[model samples]
Target: MCCTNNCINTENPSGNCVKGYGYGKLIDGENIKYINCLEGKCFDQYILVYAENSFKAPQNSLNYSLYYFEIKCKFEREKSSVWMNIGLRNLNTNKYIYYYANNAKIYNEKDEAFNVSINWKNNDYFGCGLVYPPSNMTNKSPYVFFTQNGKEIGEEILLKDNSESYKPFVWLKSLSVEANFGNNLEAKPFKYDISDHLILK
Candidate 1:
């Protein structure tokens, strides 16, 4: 789960003030009252928040064939035109691959869009994952995948230049979102059955 200590670094592109709360919750200060401001002239800005911990594929594993990390999240905003995104960022390269919930498209760091057929609404559950295959496999390239309500969406996107580790992130405009990072599986299990893809070691 994305707790307060784990999720940090809110990057506001438009220089507007933003706040992040517990349970991976983030809220834009656009519609809220800005206290201690000079005449309250600060404009609205989009922000990107990232997790402090980065996940890496397990190495020197004899039983596990594949390594993967996933997150299940729900949009807490009301029905609107505002955009929200969830994805993973490479810790070393700082590259990103994220899913745009409103447009149902996946975008990379270069802003290239890959179309998907599904659309999501308010309070709907959606997620993204990164999978890394074993070195013995023919294709050792790592790939990213998305899900909606525990079901896979579109095809897996291969990353030829895989980074050593990645951190989960959320991009918000004017709403809030909550995420489950699979920290305590017994308390809050993941929507996707991550166990199906690999052998528990």
Candidate 2:
């Protein structure tokens, strides 16, 4: 799904919004065009943007017992210390788990951090994947994983809460990022080989 146009903190009539405090403009239906903040000490604020629709996987597939939704994104410009957060947020609970690009860590809704020791640079391709086991597999649990430039990074993190209300989201600061939600593989192929993870029926 494409990003929704209803941006946050973009209604500065005086054109004096603090630098790095507002959402970037969405361009070409998938890319987030960077908006330069006013000249001053950069005010650090994360602009949260959600996709146009929630992701849903096909249910009850015997051969494909695990299902996953992945988002591939490239860091176009890295103008700030803290770059961005890419992950999934539960619509009902409002809880989120994201990969923090600055410190190479993962963070949950409680502000807890998990160190993954993977550094990224400008123009590097990175992404997050949410994998869920089949409903019939009671022993299995849902988890989150990271990928960089067509390769998996770190380990798969299992979620404590098994709710399936999660949706893809991104928190941006002063960064220009291009995201692909795997809506059409032919148009924008994912950097990671997602077909190896789960087969979508």
Best lDDT among the predictions, by candidate number: 2
Give candidate 1 misplaced runs (Cα > 4 Å). Answer: 1-44, 63-78, 199-201
Q: Model 2, 3: alpha-carbon shift in Å? A: 22
Score each candidate by Cα lDDT. Answer: 0.60, 0.64
Candidate maximizing TM-score: 2
Off by over 4 Å in 2: 1-23, 40-45, 57-59, 63-82, 109-111, 199-201
Estimated TM-score for each candidate: 0.69, 0.75
* Residue 136 displacement in candidate 1 (angstroms): 3.0
Inter-residue clash pairs, candidate 1: none
The digit string of per-residue lDDT tens for model 2 on 1-201 reads 113333343342123233334346666656676555444644444566777676554477454333334444444334454467788887768888788777888876676888886777667687777766666766766677778778887767776664566788777766667787777879988888876657532
RMSD of 1: 7.5
- Write one digit per residue (lDDT tens) for candidate 1, span 86-176: 7888877888888888788888766688998987665566677776666566446667778877787877777776556888777765444
**CA displacement after TM-score superposition, residue 119 of candidate 2 (Å):** 1.2
